[model samples]
Target: MKLVKSQPWRNPDTVLAQLIQSCARTRNLDRGKQLHAHLVASGATPSTFVANHLISMYAKCGDLYHAIALFDRMPQRNLVTWTAMISSFSQNNKFGDALRTFSSMCAAGIKPTQFALSSAIQASAFFASLEFGKQMHCLSVKLGYDVELFVGSNLADMYSKCGSLVDACRVFDEMPDKDEVAWTAMIDGYTKNGSFEEAIVAFRDMLRGGTVVIDQHLLCSVLSACGGLKAGKLGRCLHSCVVKLGLESDTFIGNALVNMYAKAGDMESASSVVGMNSHGWNVVSCSSLIDGYVEMDQIEEASRAYISSRRQGIEPNEFTFSSMIKACASQAALEQGIQLHAQVMKTSFVRDLFVSSTLIDMYGKCGLLNSSIQVFDEIQHPSDISWNSIVGVFAQHGRGKEAVRALNRMISRGNKPNHITFVSLLMACSHAGLVEEGLEYFYSMNKTCDIEPREEHYACVIDMLGRAGRLEEAREFIAGMPFEPNAYGWCSLLGACRTHGEKELGELAAEKLMKLEPENSGIHILLSSIYASMGQWEDVKAVRKLMRDSRVKKLPGFSWVDVNNKTHMFGAEDWSHPQKEEIYEKLEELMVKIRKAGYVPFTGSMPCNLEESLKERLLHHHSERIAVAFALISMPATKPIIVKKNLRVCVDCHSAIKLISKVEGREIIVRDNARFHHFADGMCSCGDYW
Candidate 1:
């Protein structure tokens, strides 16, 4: 539709402005310019409104230069033109330019409107520049924009994002009236910044005042923060809110409910939330269920959920791949992971960083390092996740030197390492007994990189120092921690104490461990063993009585191996297999042959239990013992035997495996919670560090 020109008016300025409006309404900047030229040629005085619209057209059409040029040429301008320029700069992410524009606008003797001030505040929020945001807030009130709801919301959000929730509340309360957006901004500010309790408080106030309705977005925000906390009471209370609102079947809320319950360790609640749905498995809901199952280590359940997700016609995204790959890694299900890899290749997300990195991690953990490396190389630009995954794979393989090489390569390529990168490096150093390297990296993590060390980082350092027999240093380090020592930190020291035969320190560390895990009998047993090793047999008897009295038993150790398309499982002293007799016969013969080749029994392992002779028998039928025997029978000689253990392999087993490695001239790789020990040619990669 063509814009009809307004009739010539008694006010020539008004007639020129009308013609300008007609040109602006046409959205033809060229025509507006031509009309402006005609007005200038006709010597008609320009009105502020005409100039403002001309500025708006320049700003709106992504022509900030023309906008600024027009504003400079105008004899008179209003706050609208200034607001338009500032907002345009911000919308283009020219934040510095926006700030400069605001400064210039102020210098031009025009007080900014709330629209301009709010736009500047939002830019501050994006950069987390609260000082600037605060200045804007002060100006807002001085300029009479503080009472505006949108302005207040922007200021509150900026304050909250800068970790100043108190000021955010001050601005929020200053508003005489608030809209849903204001309420959502305040609530989201708290929730996004991890202030869940405060969010709940504000939400409750909103409910009581009837200020706003809790929508699905608000519920998801609160529920995400609720996931890390064990708040079954609060979770159930939130469930009641959902029920009252009749939002139980809402896809997003249902997904959030699943995550909240799953993290609270209420699997029944989590399962019920997902089970109630027949075919409402949208991408968000499907991913949440998959995450819940993986977090619980129900790999098979996660797989079934993945299948159901595909059936529901919601295509999987990066998060879905992350969850499913983690499931296969935890289960060590290589075949299923391979199938998933094929599917990942077919998806449009094949090159996505998250999807590819998880795939690398899964394949690496599955002992397919070549596959992991291939995927890593295929990445156009690897993220820290990709680098960390490859490095972790090397560390897990007892390839500390290779891991360090990989890390160095990443750094050489200008890829900065994060906490995960440092973790993999520290782990590699610990496994390879590179004490000095671990120390250097630990110090560099904070001093050079400025990555504030978390408890896990400190725990790795403690474990490294302890494994290196620097017990005093480890104790001092723990004492110097800014935060209280956690279970992992103390547990690492405890493991070191046990390793280095520091019975006194071992007892002290056990005390800490016992406090952290009150019902844990393993720490008590380790303390008893340390005492008995030092000839305090009475204390050993006392610990035995305590364990029996507490009715706490040691966790059974199990091992599984795959060969000839069949999986074999072994438990400690397990003679349940039909071929047990034959297995024992072969073991007896191999032991005799190995002993003839200078192998001897290491009995220091037996005193953890009461009977010395029975302990020897138990060691003879231990899981690793059974696993090695099965390897000899099932696989050919000269092939390396890899065994993954649930816990650290015992000292006696370590020595026995070394003897076997030399006697049979075979390589055996044993992976446990602490590190990997590769026995080859009578040497273990740990170098007796274990």
Candidate 2:
């Protein structure tokens, strides 16, 4: 095979093609061009074989311009030539051009090969064009290539990307030989479509079939399914598989493992996975851990994870910021929220719609309505979520009129109010005692917005009526519902009955609730409170006994206030704070001052059989009172106290806080499970309705 200078090998076409392929593999465009020049200077007309290799070499080197130039000048094109050009176009993501070339090849009576068909199907997959993909499938069937391994895999992938998992499965089943490519496509498709159970089953089938080899990609898809189903055991098994295959060091595999463990609520395992891959700790892994902590209600851990990620030089993405902000909102941590807002301002994500919407929600939940409004105003073209955030902010602050105004503005701006928008709006009316307006919106759900009232909507209406002391009307509304009332509906009714002291109806509602949620401690507690309020000691005793027999324990109530980026929690008569003595002294002093200013204890909120003085004392030491006292002693005078409670604010504490606000000349914002109460100058934002 030696070449001579006087006479180059008689047929050097094969050698030239080999040299061109080597250049293509190395992506050496200059060397490939030199080879082309050498071929031209040798006084030889390049064969079709040599020319196709040159075209492919230019394409692999990312010189599509040269590739197309060579292609256009080819005198006689073969099937291999057309396939190479189509593959080059597809590989370069010139999908439209690739499809057009395929069509032109067919028009020129050049039948397609399996490689060409695969490339064409790939282009259709990118476009998610099911109709065009079906046409390609029909063509493959006509050419008797449908059962070819490569062609079948591409068709399956195309159908899956088009969201037609049914067709994908059909094509996959018809494949004579299922490879890893075909199996991965089917399993990944199931996961992406939220058919998590189907995905798990398919993975099991693939394993039991013992045909396709297990790989990181297949394991990643299965792990995602396990996460979606919260099947921690299955995820762990997949983790074992990943380790055995030595794929744990792979970046994608690492991220998938972290995400799977996070979704499974195994934060410790998620953290370990992150630690194992410290060098590859990316935003995806960090965000997943933070989001997991947030989901588990561990805001502190979530915050710490975010800080650690930043210290490790992992920049926070929009999702990381959103989850952290949501955690801040959940805890009413204003100082931390402010810090995060400043951080957001320095990043390009400040203009991100998702981040902006989350910022608005955080400010609103932190009792910074003005800041929420400002964030909303800053959005040039606010999305429906942003508008909903503003409306919800108004709703949280008991500004029903303002919420309605925001809704009107949203409509004027051509943003259609979705179910979430109306939920906030209805809750606003309920909190503000705008019962008639709430009913109007409820009716308009179907007539105007074409949204049928869901269970939550019906529950909101019942709450509105209940808040307005219209218990009978609330009951009638529940009865008139299209379906039987769910637990939420009955619970709303029962709470309203308790509020209005309708003991008989409260018992009926409690009965229904017990059947629906027999182990719910709140139902028993609310029913007992109803009996206690009516001075039915014997009935209260019976309800307590029933709770004991059923083993339903009441969840303890606690309130937390954030000051200087630190959260201080308080329970009833809490003595756990480092400055508990000062907090108690401040509480006594405030109680005295409010009493002198005509603040009388509302002992009715106690709901217990006790002496009047004891009831009053117990009422005075509620968690919110202790938290407020701590805030008053610890925070600066200029700063408003924002408290978050795990339960509803009782009437006695509400009244005392109102008088305390007047006595101390301080604004107190308290967020309970139900709504926000802005206590200032002896008045609450709910107008004494909630």
Evaluated with lDDT, which candidate comes out highest?
2
In terms of TM-score, which candidate is strongest?
A: 2
How many clashes in each structure?
0, 0
TM-scores across all candidates?
0.74, 0.84
**What tens digits encode model 1's per-residue C-alpha lDDT throughout 1-690?**
122343433465566556666665666778777876776687865677777766666565556787777777877767887787788788777888888889998998888888889888988888898888889888998988986988999988889888898999899998998877788788888877788787777777888897576777777766766775656778888888888988887877888888788777677787778778753467776787788889877767888888987887778998898889888777556667788889888988889988888888777666666788899999999987789888987776557788889988998888888988888788788877888888788877787777878877888888888888999998888788888667777777776787677877787888888778878766776677677667777788887787788787877888775555466888988988778888898778767876786766656634464577676777777888788778777777845676767766877788778778887788776766545666777777666656
**Which residue pairs collide in model 2, if any?**
none
Model 1 pairs in collision: none
Candidate 1: residue 295 lDDT (0-100): 87
**What does candidate 2's lDDT look like per residue over 1-690, in tens digits?**
233344475567777788899899999999999999987898877899999999899989999998999899889899999999999999899999999999999999999989899999999999999999999999999999897999998998899899999999999999989888788888988988889999999988888989789888888888888889888988998899899999999888898888899999999999999999654589998999999999899987998999899999998989999999889888777888889899999999999998999899988887778899999999989999899999988888788999989999998989999998999999899888888988998998788878888888888888788888998887788778888777877887887887789988888889999999998887888888888888888888998899889888877899988888777888997788889889889999998999999988866535578999888888889999999999898889888899999988887798899999999999899999866888888887776654
- What lDDT does each candidate get? 0.78, 0.88
Instruction: Rate residue 242 of model 1 by lDDT.
Output: 87
Prediction 2 global C-alpha lDDT: 0.88
